[model samples]
Target: MKTSLQTTAFAFATSAVLAAPALADEWRLNNFLPETRPESAQIEKFAEDVNTALAEKDFSIEVYHGGSLGLPNTDLLRVVPTGAVEMSLMWANYLGRDAPALGSVFVQGAISTVDELTDVLPVAQEIYEEEYSEWDVTTVGFVAIPTLSVSVFCRDEPVNTLEDLRNVKLRVWAREQVETFERLGVAAQIIPQEETYVALRTGVVDCALYPALYAKTISLQEVTGYASFLYPMASAPYALGVSDALWESTDPEIRDAITQAADDLWDRTNQYDADIENEMAARESLAEEGIVWSEDFPESDRALFVEAVSETWKMLAEEAGGNALDYRERMLTALGR
Candidate 1:
């Protein structure tokens, strides 16, 4: 009983609905930091950016923060290459056992400040691309959250001078940090980030070296009485990597969009960190709450520390050998040292 015009319109609508494609790809991005940290916020921003940029594409990114995926920070390099997870923000130094050259970023005094770290990133990116490719992953980019320094937080007394660190038990993250402390005559213990708070409170370690933002995250200021804003001995290089298979299979346009999103995220996060006002204000708030902030150690002590840590780099380079050694040399040259 339908008119010929009405029947034609009904047929056209059915074909259009059937022709529309469903969302076919979903990517999982794993992050180790809790959602509250700026690092995690940036990761979330990256997801949103990529999704928006690729709105016409049939792909989506879902971020899993705070290790909700049950992957430890150390297992990222091993797990991410298998295509089980589409991407991850991994701490580069955790792979030191197998890739010492990649771990070199965590070597105390290797890069000094965030500006130096930024300057060396091009060379670092090349090294990471070559190295991560071998593991079947594609490097997205390197991220520096906040800045490149770690402050000392202590329970018994303030570490205002290098001499104060002598014989003091401190919690460290990597072998490079341990070697750096050893050179200063301090006892260093490798502690996982999750366990550091309880260890500090229970007196298992007298002092700890961590980013100031992290201290606030774990509420260490409530447990520790002093903090010293020392020049960074080492900064963990954070890298975002995607599975090589996924990268190859993605549409070319989508791939380009994702890359652009990564670059945008890096620029935006660096600008946020460079502002300094937010960080200083947070520190001031902490100070008002009774945390004693010590003056920076003398330049002479910093010089000696840098010199001593440089020796450790030579040992690392020799140990890493082959491409790692080459990469290390390239990084050193890039740093103009």
Candidate 2:
């Protein structure tokens, strides 16, 4: 009953429908840190830049901070490559058991200065890429946090030497710190940063192994009057990881844009060696807040601490168990230590 003209038109409509491209849903990026941190701002800017470049693409990005999407930090290595989550900023030190290779890559006390840390980062980045690829993910970017210097802040008196630390309870952040201090014969315990102020005020701990730059955050000057510099606080920077599936599917132009944005982030953090400068400024501010600073933690004692920490690093590599020793040696070589 249909005319030839009508049949032809129907055929043309079906062809057009078949030729249309399928648009993708918004890609989500999970940030495990609070929105208040400076690094969050940098990440948001990265997303903004990438989205701008991706305006013509079928896909876009939306960053979710503080794990609002219920993605667990500990399970990132297992979950990231499966494409269940498209992208995430992973904190390596927190994932010791989930991915030992990641934890073995680096730690907080690895270096004594930001410059030294930066010098060794090229090697570290390589390890990160290699380890993440095994999980079927690609490294896209890095978010460098503030370089807070590690120090001991005590409530009433100056914690000057090894013996002073042994006299009063010392609060530390992780097992690494606990082991390092215990090896030096100091009584130390793991106390969460958020609860540190309350712990110090209530006499639960007499001293805390904290960062001077961050002391102002919890107003440590109020509870702790004495502080001493220990070393440059170093840890693995948050890594921006993309699922290999998603990365491979991306258009080349968009992919380049993402890579450019990530490169910009790395350059931003290292440009002026400004993080250490900021830490120095914060120390001065803490002093203004009535906190007295000291350099009485002698080089002799520091050498002992570093030696103990080095042993812990080896233990971490052994637990990781997959050419982790090679990675450690490469890192040590880069550090010239």
Q: In model 1, which runs have C-alpha deviations exceeding 4 angstroms?
A: 1-24, 56-58, 233-237, 272-279
Error of 1 at 317 (Å): 1.0
Residue-level lDDT for 39 in candidate 2: 76
The prediction achieving the highest TM-score against the true structure is 1
Instruction: List the global CA lDDT of all models.
Output: 0.73, 0.76
Residue 16, candidate 1: Cα error in Å is 42
Model 2: weakest 10-residue lDDT segment is 1-10
In model 1, where is the ten-residue run with the lowest total lDDT? Answer: 1-10
Return the lDDT, model 2, position 261: 85
Candidate 1 collision pairs: 108-233
lDDT of 1: 0.73
